[model samples]
Target: TSEDSEPWHIYTDLGYYSVELIAESQNCGADTLLIDSIIHVLNPSFISTIGNQDISIFPNPVKDKLYINFNKNLNNPMLLNIYDLNGKIIAQKDILSVAPGILELTFNRNKTQKGTYILRIQNTEETIFETKFILN
Candidate 1:
């Protein structure tokens, strides 16, 4: 019940299942419950990976566009900031929208010097990932 303001049980067609509850000071007296009593459920798996740890940059010695892929959903309106080796912001773009899949970023290396640069990807709150690349 909402008296405890916590999810206690999930109910399914077959039976009732209990869920872990986070006790709040206001819920000390009232017990929250979730009941699951359904049956004939299929086992489903949903995989989601976070952070930029698993991201890859192809054609490291990039000449043109850079491709980025993630296994998880990224924040809407992601921010891409490119900085030179001297820590100067060379380019910046706001990714208005992103799907839960692969993303491609095109950079005109012709304007950038043939050296190392830092690419920073920031979501709404924090920096999701960062990488360095060279243009040859």
Candidate 2:
């Protein structure tokens, strides 16, 4: 309608998005416009604290397995844990220092429910990274 001069939209997932808008006029006919990668949506989860800037995760709203990637090679063994917002440990794994510095682990679907989770990656000394993510 004419009230849609300014419209709002919501994206349910994290990825690059393209938007297409078509305008019609009685005398001017119709015109179409498309914008590629117009809206880039990221994980809506809130990260509490991050000690390291080199760590990252993909495919947020993770299902079965969560992939963790380190931008640099690791020098120490790492401990990865997933916890609820209330600080309950849901899953934990010991990730030894490897050649590629990339770690992968599976989350049991029958164990944890869908919600926001905090991922804590640590070494023997201290916590290296902690970020919140959504689980599907």
Candidate 3:
């Protein structure tokens, strides 16, 4: 429940949602109102050349920094994006290349909040990799 008139978040699976509001009074009877399919939660997905299991990032629940570890060598510059639950890009970074072995790509953390986030690594053509992580 919310105290003010501002909006709130309801963490759930990807699907359409409807809101229902009920008002009750001691003197008067109860009234109900519902708006169907107002909110839509979509899965952030994209077609890419690489598979999801091909890359891995350590410390799933990261705190200060995020380390992206992978074995594949990439010559193209990778575009890193950090997205919030609402599919908003909270932070991003551009890397020149990824050498074989463990590598870390750090970005600004001032806007990161405690919630599930999506880390998307892409190239100039299309999205290469995408996964979800938690921020503490």
Better-scoring candidate (lDDT), 2 or 3: 2
List the candidates' TM-scores in order.
0.54, 0.60, 0.60
lDDT of candidate 3 over 16-125, digit per residue (tens): 88888777789998998999999777853332224446578878667777787777778899888888767798887898987777766554567555767788889889
- Write the residue-wise lDDT of candidate 1 on 21-122 in tens digits: 434576466554554543333321121223577565666767777777666655478888888756899888888766667677776756765666677888
Question: Which is better, 1 or 2, measured by TM-score?
Answer: 2
Residue-level lDDT tens digits of model 2 in 1-136: 2336665443557899898888989999999899999887785344455888888886686987888878887779989898986789998888777455567877778887777789999999999998877777
Candidate number achieving the greatest lDDT relative to the actual structure: 2
Candidate 2 residues lying further than 4 Å off, grouped into runs, are 1-45
| Arranged by TM-score, best first | 2, 3, 1
Q: What is the lDDT ranking, best to worst?
A: 2, 3, 1
After superposing candidate 1 on the true structure, give the runs of residues whose Cα lies further than 4 Å from its correct spot.
Answer: 1-51
Off by over 4 Å in 3: 1-52, 105-110
Worst 10 residues of 1 by lDDT: 40-49
